[model samples]
Target chain A: MASAIINGMPVEITPGETILEAAKKLSVKIPVLCKHPDLDATAACGICVVKIKATGRTLRACCTPIDSGMDIVTEDAELVQVRREVLELIMSKHPNECVTCARNQNCELQTLCADFDIRHMELPSLVPDIAKDTSNGTIELDPRKCVTCGRCVQVCQEKQNVWALSFLDRGIDTRIAPAGDISMAESPCVSCGQCSAHCPTGAIVECDETQKVWDKLIDPDVVCVAQIAPAVRVALGEAFGFAPGTNVTGKIYASFRRMGFKAVFDTNYGADVTIMEEGTEFVERFAHGKGALPLITSCCPAWVDFMEKYHNDMIPHFSSCKSPHEMVGALTKTYWAEREKIDPKKIFVLSVMPCTAKKWEVRRSADMSSSGYQDVDVSITTRELARMIKQAGIDFATIPEAQPDHLLGAYTGAGTIFGATGGVMEAAIRSALFLITGKNAANPNFEFTRGLKGIKTGSMQVAGKEVRIAVAHGLGNVETVLDEIRKAKAEGKEPPWHFVEVMACPGGCVGGGGQPYGVTDELRLKRAKGLYQEDGATLWRCSHDNPYVQQLYKEYLGKPLSEKSHHLLHTHYVQRPTYRR
Target chain B: MTTATTPNVQEDLQRIAKKWKDKPGSLIMVLHEVQERLGCVPRNVCLELAKLIDVPVARIYEVVTFYNYFKTEAPGKHILSVCTGTACHLKGASKVLESLSKELGIKEGESSADKEFHLQSVRCVGCCGMAPVVMVNGAIHGKLKPESSGKEIVAQYRGK
Candidate 1:
């Protein structure tokens, strides 16, 4: 450990910890423009420069590792002047249309400028004239407002392993663009929306589809049906003054009702249905040897798109079961429509997902309309839902808590945990054991299948057979697991895993690309802990124990893989080229 | 698709990949070899190279756009580069570039409409003594009237 005297305060620094991190311990905010807590410091902005008394030189605090005997002054008149100049320069390049920008109040750059008390720009504006690229439909790239922070590009290329974005050209012309200047729709983008999640400026953001939902809600004949995803409950409270991990499921249901929805359902109930179908499929494969071993979960649409684009060879291993939201959407249009005596065409299902890819997933294929209409009419993000709640003038805190609609709303612990990484594997194992042995495991919580480890692998005793399983999140970590599976298969060896679960974003749905901004590892864990707490509190810990899910299978769909279940609850995949052209 | 004139572009790229595919910092090396043969790198060829090298197409484009040596679009029948080094700039290189652009009816770093002349400004050509040099198809014309030489040299190529 390196000890340093930072800003007249003694601090202990661990190895590889930067000066910025060291300052953070002492409650000293070393202002950074391009530095994110989750990413390595690119040192592109040059705003976090701090003076070293010993060397008599300023170093970028974000990248400079603290050394012993270093006397660092993070704040001084001179340092403030330098940082002010840097901010002014950055603002000069940034567009002057902050009033019209989506990130007007929530932007990091705007916050930094406020901290520095920057009054007016000394330098002239030199913002680019590039047109906004809404080609991706799920995300927008407003190049004119870009400060060239490289956060979005780093997250896309390194964190997600989808190299659809790049810092094209150099010097004054340097800007983020989909590779080869091709539209993001044609590029190898999975529509995870992580770029928007990490972007500090208005350069990248989730495509605002709130207007479309509002229009549908105002339609005279259209019935606005809403479903909230498992991850949304634990995160949507952040828009209000609630803490990060607060469970506002009841509050969110009430808010949706207050905002004008005919019925408010929970996506967790859909997740239970997914577990029923996915667990049955796993049992058939493991016990009766029906289909492919190592059945990969397809609930995360971003991961599904990634698998199809980058690793289509694993198509046989991918579970054909539709994601929970789509399952709920399809069922809402069919069974719910038939039972409610409403016209299926007039019923509009809008899912409030913790994902942006669900926007694209709604229109993926004809199978999405197995209920004779589009399964999901529209998919809004958790962030967008929060905006709509406020726009509807609903006092979230004052609203009385209410329960979700019974027919498609009841969920067990197994379904709720789907928001966390390794959650699907844990939830599936909980019910799969019962499907195979007719008994639930004593301990529903699988400690090995938790946390932010890139790839998790383990084996469990199932009906006297050792079933190997693996869980992977953050698209970059999946290649390692898939390569291992490929190596085993190529040599005709026993499959290394009998089951696999994948989520494209870092911390499953809880840390999705469409969640709140300023997300870090600590926040991810906190948000995931909220889901786990919900899981712990619920009486029914296994998906098989969810009575409402069982009733649905018995009444509407005959069984998990029955003809009607396959028709409305499963989907297919196609090997798509990385470049559409 | 690769241009028809370079029918063996695929095999040539495969050969380059064989030489540098597994090596680190080999993107620029492979690109140099491709540029040596093709005069300019096409987007489709880079997309193909991305697969052969097991790198993303965006990465190839990042490197290709960075360096001034590699051209993405096909160059004209005649390539013209005006030296803009410190020595050349002091010797009126801007005037030389201006006259060339006027005669060619295209800006710097762009090709003419007829695709007969490609003009670009270069940092240095390693001949500071030949200040304000204009390279026409690799034949350097130096130490002349900046205005006349730029127009006169391209006129020579046009007449031929």
Candidate 2:
């Protein structure tokens, strides 16, 4: 332990803790721009500079480790002056397009400027006219607005291990770009949006599709139907006054109605349908000795894209089921459209997702067009949906609670928990056991496969046969789990797992790229807790128990892997080139 | 002086990697060796080095771009460097650079059409007394005026 006096207040801290972090423990507020709770301090922005009374030197509080017996003054007259000068210098190079920027109200730079009471423009502004890149159609990269904080670069390379973003040149000419100066589409970007998630400014953000949705909503010819993802329900409340994990699914349904959507559905319904398909496939592989062993979930589109590019060998193991939102989209276009006597072509299916990858996934292949038109017309992120709610002047917090449309709306507790890490695996296990033994899972919770661990392993006994399961979230963490299986396969040894579930974003979809910004583990846990609570409070706790799902199988789709289900619910993947050129 | 094929570049990068094998923070040193042999570190060479050294290509590019010493383009046969330091600048080094550029018909930092010479501006060469210094291939010429003397130096190099 290291003891220090911060502003004449003695504080104890652990070794290797940064002074900024120590000060945070002591409730000291040190302003920082480049430092983020989710990333390591780059010290790129020098605003968090502090003076040491004994040494008479100013050090960056974000990166500098505190030493014992250190006398530190975080805020003094000279420190404030230097910090202000640093901010002015940063602002000089940054574009003053805040009013027109996407992050107009929520930008960290704007917040800091307000806190410091910056009034005058002391330095000559030099905003370089770097072109905006909208190549991927999922996220936009405006290099002109970039502050070069290195947070996006850090998240891309270190945390996500994507290596899609990097500093291209030196010093003042330094700009964040794809590593080899290629477009984002050409790079190995999975369109995960973690870069946008970690960015402090409006330099990187989701491609706004709210205007298109609004256009469709106001059109007399268009019958707009919306579906909210499991993760969206848990995290959308953060945009309002509610806490991070507060489940406002009911309020969201009401909001969609006010926003002019004809009907609102829940992606949890699709999640239940996915378990039916994936669980059956797992049983066939494990019990019937058909298909590949260790079936991997294919719900997360970013993970699917990552597999198609980096780990193509794992393609056979990937479950052919479409993601939950896509499933709901297909059902809405075909099943719901037919039931309501509406034209499938005229039905505009919109998906509200907690993922940027979903925006790309909508137009990925013909399978998304299985209903004769695109299964989903527009996929808006949870953040985009929040903006739409605000734009419509709907008080989200006080909105009356309403239920989703009855056709594809009813879901189970297993579906609600799909927002969290290890959730899909747990949901799959609950149904896979029922498929094998012809009975409901003894313990529907599947308690072993839950939490924020990067990779989790557990075992379940189905029909007196042991089934090994592994769950991994975060693209970087997927490598270790994959390498282990590859090594075992090469050595002709027993496989490490019989089933695997992977979510590309850290902490699953709750900590997704398009979730509320400024996410931390605490927020991920709270959001995950909200889902689990919804699961516990629900009448039906198993996917197989969803009456609507059973009705779908009985009325439209014959069975889990029937030809109709395979045509509409399943999709194929091809090995993709990492670079477009 | 030479362009390396795919196999040759891989082999050369492998040799460089062997020298820095099991060494921590040796990517920059390996990259230096690659630039020394090939005149510049090309994209393929960087990819090869990243594979051999078990580092990401993005990280290699980060290190390469951070240092101005590392060149990404092949340099010319005879490099002409004019000192642009404070002392040299005060002594009309900019005018000397201008005259040299006009005489050679090539802008600063560009190679001549014949691929013989490349003009560049640099900081001090550690001799303030010899302000307005020009170095051609490490042979320093001091105290040369921008007018005729700088043009004569370019003409001399052209004839070589």
Candidate 3:
């Protein structure tokens, strides 16, 4: 360890550590634009440049290695001028679109401009004359506001392993784009929304469905029903100024009612239905050797779309089940409408989702209404819902807690956990174990499937057979797990897992692309904690235990895999063209 | 399709994968190697390499399609990649791109019908000192004038 005096405070750091790393240990705030903790320091931005000593040599704190007896001045006058100049140069190319931008208050660049008290750019602003691309269905990109920070590129490539974006062209003409300058929809983007999630400016954002949802609510002829995903409860609170792990399920239900949603339903009810069909399919497949082993969950639309486009070869491994949201959409337009004596066309089924892909998923041709209408009329993100509440002049925090309407809203703890990464796998195991053994398993709390870990695997005895299961969240992690399976199959060995649940986004729906921004590892875990707490407090903790789901199966669908259930609940995958063949 | 037993090609891929297996950002390294060997990271190569490394082919495809460096489809005979870093941006790379687009008769990222040349632009190549740099088949040409004709560059490659 080397000791250094920074701003008159002595701090100890590892011998080879950078000055920025040492300062971070000492709890000193240092503004950095080009320096990411996970990436190599480019020092191109020159914003983290600091004064070394009386010698007046300014060095980039991020790139410079720490040495013994080093005297560092982080906020010297000369250093401030250089930093200000760097900021000015960055500001010159940046479009002054902050006020009306989606990331107006959340932008890091905007915050830095405020922190540095930079009133105007000394250089002329060179805003790019590029048209906004809204082809991706989930995200919009306005190149004019881009500062070419390459943070979005790094995050897409390094973290998510979905390098759908990069900087294209040389100096003055440089811009971020997919290969071939193709529209985002034309590109192999999975609609995971990670690029939008990491973007520091208004350059990228999830598609806003706020107006469409509002129109549905105000229509006197329409009966609008809102279904909230399990993850929304954990994250909706953040938009209302609540902490990361705050559970605001009741409050969310109340707000939806105030917003004129005739019925506030729970997607968890549909999640329970999903678990039954998926679990039963797994058992039947394992017995008959008819279906693909290690069946991958298709609840996450981003994962499904990614498989459809790139990994079409592995489509057989995916379970033929619609996501909980899509299932609820189908049920609302069919069974639920019949029970309520409401016309299918008159009912508008809206989903409050934590995923940007849900917006795309609801529009899928296979997820269409049997009554000649779209299954889900509209899907709005958790962030968009917050905007709607604010727009409606409703104070979410002070709103009286309310309950979701019965039938669809009556969901068990297992269904509520669909928010977190390993949630679906855990929910499946709860019902699978019960169905296999005709009794609940010895351990109801499956702790293995309840963390922020990228991938988790476990085995348990079910019906006198050992069933191996693997759970992977994040497309990158799914890649690793799939590779292992391929290698195993090549060796003439049976794959380890009988079932696999893969969520495209990290930490599952809780860390979805449509959630509030600035989510880190800590924030994802906090959100997961909230999901488990919701599970713990619920009266019923198993998917099979959800009486409403069981009633739906008995009264309407007949059984889990009945022909009626298959028509509404199940779907197939499509293989797409690859460059190789 | 002619399967000419290109053991060297397969060996080259394995060698690249081995070199980057333990490195940070192995995916990018693999992509760089694949692009270098094939002049573009073909989707088949990505699928095969992904299978070899035991990673999801989707991940390999995602990286190849995501980064501007990795070309999914084949480029024209002469691939021209222009750098558009902040330094190049200040030096009028857009005018150069516009001029190139007109001369090549194809927009950026597109190849001409004759397959003689493909024009594309990349982000910073870490050569900010050279305001406008263009790379053709791994060779760097620094400080290009914005008004330089794209046909002239293509002619030079054709001559070579």
Candidate 4:
């Protein structure tokens, strides 16, 4: 441990801890724009400059590690002046469209401007005249508003490893754009929206579909049904001044009714059905040795797009199950419509997902049209839903807790934990172990695959046989595990693991690209805890134990992996080029 | 599809990238060789170089666009560069450029109707003492008047 005096207060810093981290620990605030706790500091924004007492030299606290006997002044008159100059320069390039931008008042740069008492710019504003790129319907990129902070670039390149967004030009002309100068849709962008999630400005953000949703909601002929994803409940509270990871599921359900959602459904119930199908599929592959080994999960749409583009060789090994919301969407238009005697055409299934990729996933393949109509008519992000609630003048905080509607609304603990990373694998293992052993899992928790680790491995006894499993989240960490498996398969060796799960976002859907903004590892852990806490508090801890899921199979769907189930619940993959031709 | 007929350009890019395979931070050098061979760094060529060098196309474009020497589009058969530096600006460089544009019927940074002559404004060519300098295809014409001298020089390179 190294000792440092930040603003004359002595503090012990751990090895490799940055001065910013030390100052944060000491409660000495060092303002920063580009340094996010979840990503590596790029030192793009120069707002966190600190002065050294001995050398009188200045350094960026974000990228500089604290020395043993260092005396760092976080803020001083000179440093404040320099910081203001930096802010002024950044403001000169960035458009002053805060009142009109989607992230108005919530923007970091706007907040800093207010904090620094910067009402007028002494320097002339030189906002770039670059046209907005709205090529992808999931996200919008307005280069005019960008401050060149490099947060979105780092998130898109290093954190996600998508290689879609990059610094195209250099110096004054430098701007964030897709590789090869292609449109975002034409690029290998999976529409994860992590770039927007990490952006300090409103330069990158989710494409607003709330107006369309509003039109649909107001239409008297339309039966607008809503399904909330497992992750949305835990993170949506952040927009309404609630703490991160606060579970607002019940209030959200009530608000959906207030917002004119004809019927409220839970995607977790669809997640339960997914476990029934995916667990059965895994059993057929791993336990019975009837199909390919190392069956990968396909719940996360971003991972699905990434696999289709980069890892198409793993197509045969992918589980054919649609995402949880898609499954609910399919059921909402088919089973629910048939039972309620509502016309499937009039029933527009709207899914409130904690993913931007789901916006693309809804229209990605034909299986999403399994209900003789579009399964999911529209997919909105958690942030968008929060905005809609506020726009509707609904008091979200004190809203009464209400229950989701009907048979499709019920879910198990396995369904609730689908929000976190390794959740799908754990949910699958919970049911898969039971299917093979014909008894409850010795431990339904499946603690081995839990937490915020990028990649996790575990071995479990299924029917007295050891089954190897691996869970990988954050697309960058997936390549190593997959390459190892590919190498083993190429050398004619046994498959490394029986089952593998992947979620494209860092901490799965809880840290989803469309979740609340300003997400950090601390928030990720709390969100995961919220889901796990829900799982622990529930009565039915396993998918197979959900009584409603069993009734659905017995009455409507017949059985897991049945021909009818495959028709509505399963889909195929198409090998896509990395770059649009 | 034009690249299909020009196999040598692709081969040259592959060879250039291979030569710098062992050297890190040599993307700029590799790109320089590509620009020298192709006259300009084409978008399609950028994609090819990205694969050959195992670097992202964006990274290559970032460096390529940074230096004004590397152009993204094809240039003309003969180049007409006007120095617009402080020394040349004071010496009627803007009037000289006007005459050149009127002679070629093309604006600055544009190619002629026949694609034989291209015009661009550049910084000092180390001949600032001469002032109002203009270079065409590596032949310097210093202290030329804007009247008919600049137009005559441009017309000389029109057919060549």
Candidate 5:
């Protein structure tokens, strides 16, 4: 190893290490777009140019190696000017639409521009006439705004392992698009929204539903009741400048009130209902040998969609219960409306989701209301709701902490954990234990399924039978788990798990596509902490103990799988075309 | 055409259901197999599968519509999957896509009027070193240049 003295710091470097790598070893930050750690260094950005002590020439630090005695100045005036010029050149061809663009506040390029104070473009703007792509269900792409950073491409190919987006054409005609310019819906996008998440500009964004939600709010006939998912509370705060794990449940309720919503409800209530129906369904399946073994969860729309299209062979394994948000919407019209003597036709259900799939979830004809209205009239992302709150000039942090409206707003800690990957399974165990053993669980925390593990499996004896369960989040993880199960079945071994929970996002609902921007491993765990804390703080931690749910079963619904419950709370799955274009 | 009776769809679903009756999540697996065989996921198949699985039919329908990949209608003869991964972006995959769309005279995700070609974009195919990759009927083609004068990719598929 060779040692170098740069910027008054002694840094040890490998034989042929670059000045940039040595600088990084000394805890120095060198900003360069074209100098990704994984990608081969092109040094085209020129932002990482550094001044050498002895040599008058400014060298591209990313590509240049550090000699043992080399002394480098990364923040000299000449280097600063060179970096500024480089950024300006990059900005010349970039769209100046950050003010009103979808990625306006959340863009990395815009942030860099602000940081460098490069307000005006000295060079001529190359405004290409490119049509925007609204063909995708989850994200829209604006070609004119693309800087061709290839971050979306890198993430799609390297991170998500889904190589759907790519750049095409020569020079001025170059634009990012799917191979063969296919509609994203027809593409194998999987609606992960990672492309939009990684995009440095407004080139990509989750489909905008802000105006539609506002329009519904103004319609007097539409008594809009908003339901916020468990994950939304943890991540929604990030859009409003709150810390990642900050619990914004109270703030969300207050903001919805300010937004003119008739009632603020919790999707966890619906989650609780899902647990009841899904748990009972699982029990029935196990007892009667009715449905598939090792029933998989159906709450994640993305997972459901994936199974329907690519893995329809696994449909019987999916539980027949609707997602928590849809369940809440369905019950709001049926169970809640009947209780309040409100017309189901007048009520509008809005879900504040952390998922793009929720948009598709609400559109299913099978999830329609018996009252002839869409069960969930609108689905808005956590980001969208944050925009609305900001647009209204409401101080989210200062808003009076308010509790959700009665009954539907009330949820147990188990329900709150439904936001994380293993939350659904943990919540189910709490209730399932009570259902089976007729007592409080010996261990309230099913710690086996908790944390950031990609896939977790646990088995517990209930009524002398080992009830095995597996929890998986993210589509990639789901594929691995399914593959394992397939292999097991091929070996003639009984499936290891009786119930499984799958969330499409990496960390479950907390990391949903529609969640607040800039999600990291630390942020997901923080959000998960908030969820578990909320679960621990709640009195009724078990689904079976939820009084409102108990009342619904006793009064309106009769039982979990009763004929009325089946028509309303419980739903079905459909096999989709395997070979989609 | 078969009548829209529940039993009819059940019979269609049973054809596949009988194959995976004992497997875990057999209903979903059978549905996938049937969809693979049928080109489109028919409502009758879903209904029959739901009944066989003993879950509510609504749940089955919900899963079908919730995902973007699931198609409720029949597909065309040839499936064209364009690669949109990062390496392809650097190699100008978008222009290749545009050229294909123009050559095919149809938008992405659309079947040709003749019902011969169905175009779609897929996430990464794990072939970053080879930028601008396209998978037509599962055959991977790399380093594609979308030239106006070039022989249209769809024409070759039509001849096939």
Candidate 6:
């Protein structure tokens, strides 16, 4: 343990913990701009400078680790003055469009300015004349508002490893841009939006489509129905002053109804169907040796895109399953439309997701329109849905709880856990066990496939045969698992792992790019734990046990891999070049 | 003053990337060899190099644009640089750049649409005595007035 005195209070810290982390334990607020919980400190923003009482030198708290018996003065007259100067210098270059900025009241810089009592910038604005990039149509880049914090660059290059964004140029001319003067859409960008999640300002943001959804809602002939993803129920409450992990699904359903949606559905229902098809696929390949092993889950659209661009060779290993929301969209247009006695053309399916990739996923390929119409009309992020709720003047706190419309609404605990890292694998194993062994998993809870580790591996026993599996979250960590698979295949070894699950964002959907800002590992864990708690409380914990899913199979689809299920609930993959140019 | 790229830029990039594949943090080094072989790094070469190096082309562009040493495009027929060092800045170098920009219709760090003229600002070049100098294709024209001289020099280039 390391000992330190911060502001005259003695504190104990693990060896090598940074002053910022130690100060956090002491509740010493050290304002930071470029330090993100998910990344290493770039020390680009000089706001967190703290004075050493022993040495009388100022060091950035974010990067400086606590030394033994070191006395740190986090707040002093000189330190405050220096921090104020740094804040002013940064603010001088930032535009005065806070009122209209996407981050408005939530930006870290705006909060810092107010905290430091910075009335106005005395320095002239040298804000760049950089052009806005909306080329991707999923994530937007407003470079003029950037503060050179480097959080987005770090997230893009280090965490995501997609390398779609980089800090171009140097000094005053420094800016973030795609390589080779290409638009983001033409680059290897997966549209995961992890960069936007870690960005401290409005420099990188999700494309706001609240108004577009509102336009569809007011169309008299259009029957706008909404579906809420598993992660949104846990994270959307952060904007409405609810705790980070509070499950607000009931209230979200109510809010959608008040916003003119004709029906409210739960995406968890789709997730359950995804497991049914995917679990069957896994069994067909693993037990009967029908297709490739280790079968990779295709529930995450961002991972699907990444696999197509980066690891196209693994396409044979990808399961032909459409993501949960797409499943819901297809069902809403086909099954639900028939049951509700409405024309599919008159119905508009709105998906409120905790991801920016879903926007791209909905329009990824024509396969998404298997329902004979564009299955999902529009997909909005959790942040956009929160904005719409506020726009509707409905107090989420006072909103009456409501249940989703029945046919495509009910879900199991297996479906709800789809938001967390390693969750899809756990969910599938719980049901795949039944599909293969014809019995419920004696111990349905697989504790090994949990937590925020970059990569998690485990094996399950089924009929005296071992089923090996690996789960990976965060794109950078994905390379190792894929390389291992490649090496094993090259050596002609029996499959190293029988199944694989991947989620693009770290901590899975709970830490998605389109969720509320100020994301951290703690918040991810909290949100994931909320989903797990909801799963634990539910009556049915396995997708095979979802009663509504059984009804769909009995009355409509007939079986898991039936022709109708394959048409509406499954899709294929194609190899994509990283750069169009 | 030679380009590192050969007639087949992609083949050259593949060869260079293969040489540095086992070495970490050698993308910039490989790119240097590419830029040295080619007068300027082309878009397609960057795309091919990204595949060989297993990196996003965005990082390649970031590094290319950061250092003034790497050029992304071939030089224009007429090169113009307005020195913006201490001596020149003190003597209204910005106004001189503005006039040159207006005359040539090209901003600093950009080439004219016709690719005829390129304009940029440079640091000090040991010409303190000749403050406010404009270097045209390596020839120095010093002690210039910001307004009329810029248009006159541009017209001289246009006449050529």
- Residues A41-130 of candidate 5 have per-residue lDDT tens digits of 556567788887778678888889888878888776777677788789878878787778988778767776777789778899877887
Residues forming the 10-long window of minimal summed lDDT in candidate 5 chain A: A33-42
The DockQ values of the predictions, listed in order, are 0.67, 0.40, 0.08, 0.51, 0.03, 0.48
Task: Name model 5 segments beyond 4 Å from true.
Answer: A1-6, A11-27, A32-73, A161-163, A169-174, A578-580, B1-160
- Candidate 5 chain B, run of 10 with poorest lDDT: B55-64
Candidate 1, A1-581: lDDT as tens digits = 55889988899988888899889999998888898887999999999999987676999999999998789999889999999999999999888777888888889999999999988988988888898999878988999888898999999999999999999999988999987778889889999999999999889888889999889889889998999998898999998978998999999989878878999888999999999999999998889999888899999999999999999999999899999999999999988999999999999899999899999999999989999999998998999988899899999988889998989999999999999999999999999999999998989989889999988889988878999999999999999999999999999998999999999999899999899888999999999999999999998999989999988988899889999999999999999888886
Q: Cα RMSD (Å) between model 4 and the true structure?
A: 2.0
- The deviation in Å at residue A465 for candidate 2 is 1.6
Candidate 3 lDDT, A1-581, residue by residue in tens: 66888888998877788989888888887898766554577676788888777676888898899887889888867777787888888889888877788888888788888988899777987888999999867888898888777777776666666656666665777787764456777666778887777677788898888989888788899999999999999888898789998999899898888889888889999899999999888877876677888888989998888788767878788898899988888888888889989999899999999888888887766545544678888888888988998998888889889999877888998999999988999999898878777888766788887787888988877766888988898787777888888888789899978889899888899889899987777889899899899898998999999888988988899999899888898887777532212
Clashing pairs in 6: A179-B58, B3-B36, B3-B37, B3-B38, B4-B36, B4-B37, B4-B38, B5-B37, B5-B38
**Model 6: residues >4 Å from true position, as ranges?**
B1-7, B11-23, B77-160
Tens-place lDDT per residue, model 2, A103-147, is 998999989887887888889988887899999999999999999
What ranking emerges by TM-score with the best candidate at the front? 1, 4, 2, 6, 3, 5
* C-alpha RMSD over true interface residues, each candidate: 2.2, 5.5, 7.6, 2.9, 15.5, 6.2
RMSD of each: 1.7, 2.6, 7.1, 2.0, 12.2, 3.2
Mark the regions of model 1 whose C-alpha exceeds 4 Å error after superposition.
B1-7, B124-132, B143-150
Calculate each model's fnat, 2 decimals: 0.83, 0.53, 0.00, 0.53, 0.00, 0.87
Model 1 lDDT at residue A284: 89
- Estimate how well candidate 4 is docked, as a DockQ score: 0.51
Q: Please tell me which predicted candidate would have the highest DockQ against the true structure.
A: 1
Q: Assess every candidate by TM-score.
A: 0.97, 0.95, 0.81, 0.96, 0.73, 0.93
Docking class of 4: medium
Q: In terms of TM-score, how similar is model 3 to the real structure? A: 0.81
Write down the DockQ of candidate 1: 0.67
**Which 10 successive residues of model 4 chain A have the least lDDT summed?**
A458-467
